[model samples]
Target: METRRDLRGILFVLVVFVGLAVIWRDLRYDFNFASDMHKAELGRRRETITQTVTSIALQTQIETQTELTTEIVKLSEDVSPAEKA
Candidate 1:
């Protein structure tokens, strides 16, 4: 009877250890998944910010070029009349 009781105790301890191991593995997997998702989100945000800055810079350059062209045309017209006189 004592030997049977010892066997049952050993079996119970083994089962408990297996359960704990499975729980630990599942928790580790969940943590890794969350970390990867966070990294991906950060990458997307950086790309969007870079694109917006580039677009703004291009727009400003175009506007400045247009203003300069208009001024040059006006100056040319003024000179043409004076030359004809």
Candidate 2:
């Protein structure tokens, strides 16, 4: 009877240890998944910000070029009339 009791105790301890190990593994997996998802979201946001900045820079350059072209045309027209006279 004593030996039976000792065997039961050992079995119980082993079961508890197994349960704790499973719980720990599950928690670790969840933590890793969350960390990976956060990193992916951050990368996506960084790309979007970079694209928006580039688009704004291009728009400003085009506007400046347009303004310069208009000024050059006006100056050319003024010179043409003076030369015709």
Candidate 3:
């Protein structure tokens, strides 16, 4: 009867230890998940900023190109018709 009581005590302690380990693992998993989610959001924000800058740069290039084209047209008109022929 004494051995049986000792065995029961050991089993109860083992069960408690296993439960604690599971709880710790679950908490660790949640923390890692949150960290990864935050990193992803930051990456998305960076991408958006990069895209906006690129768009602005492209718009400026287009405006400069248009101005250059207009100047070329004006210079061509200034040339004599005989020179064009």
| TM-scores for the candidates | 0.53, 0.54, 0.55
Query: For residues 14-59, what per-residue lDDT tens digits would candidate 1 score against the true structure?
Result: 5555555554554565456647776566456545555555555555
Q: Candidate 3: worst 10 consecutive residues by lDDT? A: 1-10
lDDT string for model 3 (4-82, tens) is: 4456556556655655555555456555764777656655654665565556556655665676688789999999999
Local accuracy of candidate 2 as per-residue lDDT tens digits, 1-85: 4465456556556655655555555456655764777656655654665565556556655665676688788888888666968
Model 2 off-target regions past 4 Å?
1-34, 81-85
Tell me the whole-model lDDT of each prediction, alpha carbons only. Answer: 0.59, 0.60, 0.61
Predicted structure 3, TM vs. truth: 0.55
Question: Highest TM-score, which number?
Answer: 3
* Regions of candidate 3 where Cα sits further than 4 Å from its true position: 1-34
- Residue-level lDDT for 64 in candidate 3: 58
Task: Return the lDDT, model 2, position 61.
Answer: 56
Candidate 2's C-alpha lDDT? Answer: 0.60
Choose the strongest candidate by lDDT: 3
Model 3 residue 31 lDDT score: 57
Query: Which ranges in model 1 have alpha carbons more than 4 Å from their true place?
Result: 1-34, 81-85
